[model samples]
Target: MPAALEESAKPVIIGRSSSHFTRVTRIFAAELHVDYSFRVVRDLMSSNPEDYGGNPALKIPSLQTPRGVWFGSLNVCRELWRRSSPRPRVVWPEDHDEPLLANAQELVLQAMSTEVSLIMGKLGGTGDSAHHTKMRQSLINMMAWLEDNATSVLAALPQPRDLSYLEVTLFCLVSHLEFRDVLPTAPYPELNKFCQQFAARASIGETTFGFDT
Candidate 1:
């Protein structure tokens, strides 16, 4: 993308730099060649919907666009795709009709949400509660399942595609677990390998997760 055009079309992306969901949309924006201005949400616990770009759900990664406010990563990514002159071939969640592809997508998102809950609980000083303990165990179980199925799940994805939401989210989920120390990711070799490969992309490199200064 050229600098002049990028500046002219700069959409405002509201979210924390460290958020996996936010990173997903940022990656898509980069891939789609849609330059955006990032607005950092300093406090994750802020009750103001304005903090989340008019998202009533108060979630990060909401896109403030000329058309309107998009309230989720997927929606933001789709909108970005639509705005791109030459759209890349993208495989969305709805394209996963087979059980293997569909289940993998489901599990990846579930794990991401579960990680969010666990982290929120810890930050709220409820890390030692029984529910937290159960959530931890559930996370452990889900990781194990993902590790065991990683090979087959990835193999089942459509070939010759520019990108897939399944792969992007899986990469974010696995990498975020390691990044936040929600779990030790060393045991999931397949997922780790996948991340190693995916991390080489320019889109992924530009959006490396970190705290905003």
Candidate 2:
């Protein structure tokens, strides 16, 4: 490819606009100031890896960089941070030594994955199956625990941090539940409050989720 073509490539983010996992990377991109092109994954049901930026997992939010393609949201975010100059202080999951913070990170990711499964099942016309019902119950249980523990978990996190993956993922997950009508967020006041505060960030504002047309 020509030099101009290569520079014009920037970094291509392959994912759907409405996807929470995708939004996480998009927000990270905005925060890190990494200019990139957005390539929407038109069909989530497609089995073709090409549709998902050559992700063998057929997942979205993959980042295509000159260095290589990143497979998932966290990998993409880490690469973005690596490329960032005067990098911000990012608190990774390993930084959370305490049980509260570590557990919070784990549950937030679990909730996001559960949400994905539930949404995919719905889209696949399997929403009414027994497994789907169990998944919904699991999600509800997780949310309840999160609502009770959110404050303590946040308090345990390190102070004076620029960003933490846990916070970003939690914000995306809670806001997404309401966005997709998977569940009403009103019941989880603590999570709602956190979402309201997190939503004020410029990065979060820029990456508001919306289904691809």
Candidate 3:
């Protein structure tokens, strides 16, 4: 390829706009100021890996780069940060040594995963199944815990940080619950307040959730 063509090339983010997991990476890309193209995964049910940017897990938000495809939201965000200049201060999961912060991160992710499972179950026509019922209860429990502790968990974080995975995931999870109509967020006042504050960022405005055709 010519130098111009090579310069024009950029990493591709494979995922849907409505997906919370994908939104997390998109927000990271925007905040990191890393330029990348968005490639929507049109069919979530597609068995072909190519539809998900060669992700064997058939998941979205994979990063397709010159080096290789990075799977999962965290991997893609790290890669995007690596490609950014004057990298911002990022707080990773390992930084949380205490149970409050650590467990908050755990439950945020667990709730997100549980939401995904519930959506997939609905699509799979496994409505009201035993596992699905249990997942719903688990999700509710996790959200309750998060709502009660969100303020303190956030307050306890180390100061002067550009971003943290926990915050991003929590924002996405809370916003997504409302977006997907999986649950009424009016009940989660603390989480809603956090979302309102987080939504003020430019990245959040740029990555509003919506289903893609």
Runs off by more than 4 Å, candidate 1? 1-8
Number of colliding residue pairs in model 2: 0
- Worst 10-residue lDDT window for candidate 3 reads 1-10
lDDT of each: 0.89, 0.89, 0.91
Clashing pairs in 1: none
Which stretches in model 2 have alpha-carbon errors above 4 Å? Answer: 1-9
Instruction: Point out the higher-scoring one by lDDT: 1 or 3.
Output: 3
Q: Kindly list the per-residue Cα lDDT of model 2 for residues 1-213, writing each as its tens digit.
A: 876676446898999889999999898888888888999999888999999989999887899987679999999999888877779998888898888888888888888999999988998899999999999999999999899998888777788888889989999999999899898999999999998998899998899989789
Query: What TM-score does model 1 achieve against the real structure?
Result: 0.94
lDDT of 2 at 60: 79
Give the C-alpha lDDT of model 2.
0.89
- Supply the TM-score for candidate 2: 0.94
**Tens digits of per-residue lDDT for model 1, 108-128:** 888888899999999999999
**Which is the winner by TM-score between candidate 2 and candidate 3?**
3
Q: What is the TM-score of each candidate against the true structure?
A: 0.94, 0.94, 0.95
